[model samples]
Target: MTANTGFLERTFKLSERKTDPKTEFLAGLTTFMTMSYILAVNPNMLAEAGMDRGGVFTGTILASIIAMLIMGFFANLPFALSAGMGLNAFFTYTVVLTMGHPWSYALTAVFLEGIIFIILSFFKVREKIFFAIPTSLKNAVSVGIGLFITLIGLTSSGLIVANDATFLSLGELTSRTSVVAIFSLILMAILTAKNVKGALLYGIIAGTVLALILGVTSLPQGTVFSLPPSISEVAFKLHWDNIFTLDMFSVMFTFLFVDLFDTVGTLTGVATKANLIEEDGNLPGVGRALLADAIGTVSGALLGTSTVTTFVESASGVAEGGRTGLTALSCAFFFFISLFLFPLFSIIPAQATSAALIMVGLFMITPITNIDLEDFTESVPAFLTMVTMPFAYSIAEGISVGMITYVVMKLCTGKHKEVSPIMYVLAIIFAIRYLRPILPF
Candidate 1:
């Protein structure tokens, strides 16, 4: 009836989702709460590579905002984008710290990978590669990523910790952080059980309130509002000299591999749940989504951060009934809000957000029941893909192994015709990835 309402509907197809702007806004807030941890965590990880912490912090936010807006308007998807967690860890711990490369060089590699991704997306090769993946493996990636997300939550919430004897043991139940996280989880479960709207959002706020009361983490001491950090230190600081060297090849390839699988896996997992997957098992506008990710990665490198990719955290929004780009647009607005409210946003301790991630993981696991494990041919590869993600601590590694095993099993079981040509190419790539450890330079 109103002009503004008509504009909103036309832009995001609100009627198709059967959702209003109010619900989409709430869903976006919920997604942002679950993923806001990256704002603090990504910069810290890059700082280990000798990056300017303040500069990285600004870069992270800028990259996320840019990518999410692209996803909202161009891709018209509900997914959110950010400097990815595992990819950043690998960029710091592996590329810069262990390999003796300067931080700028690593940043250059990320930029190159982004450029390559954009080229692939333009040619539609990225979409084809994703579509060639077997449906069983796609389902496995979803379940595997769900388990990986759960593992992250449990660790971040202090519910699980390293043990000298058993590798992982239960954290102290009496610890303030763990207690707050457990309470948040229970509260969310109850709310969800009661069919309450915005249960995840409510749970996160409650957890943060409890943390402030318990002092598991301290509140910010400075002024409530502060200016954005300067992006001068690292912006456009990429080291182009080493871009063509053989030593940079492995780093670039790893970045490319990890990002490719992570984006595909998130898109696959999220789109499948949203019923946006086509009858041919392809995601609509996936090329556009890949392009958004590529652009994010390039812009992140320019501004100073690691590879930016689609986040699995967006599933929280989808679970909350988000079905269009409006959710992503709303999330971008909150990210902008966070730029000035860092103190307030920073006070919401990791334990609070961990509860949201754990709950979303629980929501994602329901799809696993759709997978038929009765046939060993399908189950074996799927099982490897599902379990390897959490155990190996790499989504790309899980996808690689699952894809390799899927192709191998097909040939071994006399179902060679079932294998796609692209699958064979993936198998070789995975083989090369695994062999990198033993290869002599």
Candidate 2:
């Protein structure tokens, strides 16, 4: 083979390719379905926070397509990338609502944050952050996020989480929206259980079909959704008005830190679980993955959305037959195509995507096995992290509780000697993070 052909063969793994036409197509579809719900919900959530509707519309398409493409082309990990749950919620409620910052300022924050990440990534400074985390805590955080994402699905789907007094609300099951999502969940469960190829994809297709047949589609008909319109609207905010306020700066770092570490921790855990690391416990593409993530955030900001990063749902594809970069690329292709098919995305009921999320959530249990059950110190903190994230509806809270408990557990068990000095610094930092919003400065 010529050098060019040989290089392509190796990079794409063409020579050793195990082309499962049925499986690849399913993997592509599953990636698309994983994000279908977000296409609408993200915009809806942001729109409620005073974000431009056109910005919302354009940002989702561009960020989704750009993020997926970068993840496919550069990171070469089976995971798909996008603006994640915690960061988006943080952008909407925390920065905009609680902190009272404008969306334009938020985008400026995102752009600056991305630049910081890129600079840190190039020098490998981010590696120090990873080293600071104990393996035990890392596993716990991974499983905790799994719980966090699951809780999001449960609450959002109106599954009626139990309240303190009456104990249970049956959610909005009878509502047309909830009904479609529920049915999608059922369909996805059956297909996945039966080991059907692309079960998640099929479930999404079925759900989309059901939604369309029932007239659930919300995209205006006969309108072409292309690049320029989206470019005009997305993460495009530049607020000269609040450009130098203390509150604005405060929101910027908050968005930056939360988004930065959350992405790192989530990626580390998923990568570890997937055996994406080598025997030395090193991740070669980890820097590249982080770069892709940081760029995704910058792109989202440019397009007029909140912060963007890698979504853990890509783990679902990994759990399937997505053992190569090929899978990531396939996912990217579909995400870009969905731009033109925006109407289809808006129509697919949340329950259908819930099906994928629920199944993927279940798959997130791999990290539980990594917990050291024999060590109560490790076990207690790990369990608390997993439990609190979902129940409290806050990933930050879950992590806070975990950090405090881990520190206490280590000291009490006479294992404080085992903790790293850097871990001590982070423990102090996480404590401060927890206190910032509540305490009077």
Candidate 3:
């Protein structure tokens, strides 16, 4: 295969290239519902950053479908890739809204970061980076993301409140949002436990209907779901001027490292769960998967969104026993169909998606058993990461605190010799990112 060969030839199919069409369709439906939440939100995030709202939305649909196809046909990773959730929030609310950085600058940062990802992946440095991460921390990160995602669902669904008077807030049991979320949560659990086909899809469907009854749709023809003309509007505007900022390196560095580990961690966690990895402890065709993911990030940025990566919802697909590339190909096709069904997504309110997000959050917790809490050295950092993520309302913050604690604890315990050299390097990088002041200029 040539260096520029498409995603397929890069990853080989070791098993038979056949699967049941019905099973694949069900898997595809499951993947689609899991990702439906992002269709509207990702575009909305990039638009706030001054990007073409239409282009980003179009990009969200295009890149997601394309990426999922690559994952399906090439990598067979049983995962869907798209503009990541936290990355969008970080780009919009944190970098743009909070830091007052120009949206263009943040995007420029994403572009540079994507290039870096591709370079690291092509050169095959991902394994070195992964080696630096302690297996204990890997377990912690997988579980932490689960906890953090749960919080996102709670806040998105309005089940939880933010009180200015009260320092902390919890679920408001009397709230209708709470009732819906709890109800959906129960439904999802029952379906999952019973091994129902497309249980998550059914759960999300129930949630959306619930949202309609609660007036969350806010659309005229509640049952008729179709894309509005504006859904295809190309919206990205290149701010080449923002590319010259001195802060580009700082911002890009953050994104590059964050995405690198995040992708690897997600792959490891999911691969472990699915038993898709070989006896060598490597997921078969993982290199190709990483390349596909890096390509997705690069393409996503060019399309006008954040760096794309494999979603955790791939866990749901895997849990459903989707072993072949057909499941992913089916998912890709449905995502493309969604471009014309924007009205459908637009009608499914955040609260309903929130129920599904909460389900994904629960689904992600399957890796908790991977951690060995018997050792205080490993347990402390892992515990800190798992607890801090939701409390801090940020995954990065949780990871940063975990890295510092992991390094500092190892050093103090005189077991610093046991820590990987890459971890030490990561500790410094994370330290610099943490110490840097958030300048609004």
Candidate 4:
């Protein structure tokens, strides 16, 4: 081998992993294709919260590139990081819009969440928390987030609209935006059924084209490739004035909770697919991987975005024979190149991105099958968690109610042994939070 090839092989331990450079590169490319829809979706979501669209676009790319590199070189794992979808939804819809906090305040919460995550990872406290939450509630969180995201997509696409009578009703199905979104959703389903790579990306492109044809959106006036927009408008804009408020603490904790479970779930699920789980039922080098995720969230907040976490789409790379950090390295390179393609990504209208959000929601809800429906003790809390998120329009609320119910159900049924100490503390905390409004503090 040439010197460069020899060095890469030694660094990534390609021989020990039983893989080569070509296979790793191919797997990375496949992974990028599947998840690159984030390039179009994230900026649009953040823009709704009054952020600079161009700046968020640039920040998203930079944060993703840096995080993936860390995952490659430091963690030496085939995982990719990006601004998480459900977390971003909470950032935009719940924190900014619903709660009336400024975007900078939300950024501060994310930054704090990252710092705490780093400390927890170092102490191995994150794993303890992970195992403390019941499996049914864990699965319910995913399902709830999925429904919440789908609601966002439907409203954004004008497929569903607010009504004074029934609260929410269908929009004009004949409208151009709704038509394109429906078409894209159908196309994505067909492509996914056919086992097509990059199905969501393809759906977004087709939706954009249909929108252009229908005059729902217009084409960009400039070159497809250009210098990335300046991130000065959004970068490092954390607001500290409200940092000590109870609301801020709750928001930060929610960000911490969601990101913690999401990262652990993605890592464990994908690592299992790659057969990286050891005989002791633990993943080797997971601390480094969690550290990489923590650092990514911190950097992403500083760079102006939502909490960053490991993407489940990395399973695409693992499925394609990626077993080492080389795959992550290759995927990072693609994100670097995409920085200059802002014009193309910017022109992808909300209707097109709505399709991707809805499809992602569908993917996230698959864990619902794992929840045991026969046991009301387990199923009640899980069902409440699944329904509360979309109905209440809050991810944090779903988690709070679920925990409170789970602890109550177990205690009342004389199954209190199943509830961990950590869980009891969380349930008490959430209960007090709910009662705070009436307590005249």
RMSD of each: 1.6, 3.6, 5.1, 5.0
Higher-ranked by TM-score: 1 or 2: 1
* Candidate 1 C-alpha lDDT tens digits along 52-165: 998898899999999999999998889999999888988999988899999999999999999999999999999999999888888888888789889989999999999999
lDDT of 2 by residue, 1-441 (tens): 778656655775543545443454456567666765666777788886787666676676677677666765676666677766767787888877877777676678777788788888898767666655566677776777677667666666666556778765677677765676787778878877888777777777787777776665454566646443444644466666755778767777877777766776677656665666555445657777788888888888888887787776766675555655566677777767766766645666666676677777777767789779898998898898888877776665666677778887898889999776766777788887768799787
**What is the C-alpha lDDT profile of model 3 across 233-302, one tens digit per residue?**
3435335675566566666776776777667767765666566655444566677678778878777766
Residue pairs clashing in model 4 are none
Candidate 1 displacement at residue 324 in angstroms: 1.0
List candidate 2 segments past 4 Å from native: 1-9, 12-25, 97-101, 161-168, 172-179, 212-230, 233-236, 240-244, 278-282, 435-441
Ranking, lDDT, top scorer first: 1, 4, 3, 2
Clashing pairs in 2: 181-351, 234-303, 234-304, 235-301, 235-303, 235-304, 235-305
Find the candidate with the highest lDDT and give its number.
1
lDDT of 4 by residue, 1-441 (tens): 899889988788888888888878877875676577788888899999999988998898888888888899887899988999889999999999999999999999999999999899889887665556687777787777678768878998899999999999999999888999999889988987887756676787798899989998776786888888899999999999968999999999889877876687567556655667565446667888898899899999999999989987776576567889999988888888889875665566778767766776776677678779999899999999889888987666777788899999999999999899999998998898789889877
Badly placed stretches (over 4 Å) of model 4 are: 1-56, 72-113, 231-289, 304-334
Work out candidate 4's RMSD over C-alphas: 5.0
User: Where's the lowest-lDDT run of ten residues in candidate 3?
Assistant: 5-14
lDDT of 1 at 281: 80
Report how far off residue 20 is in candidate 2 (Å).
6.6
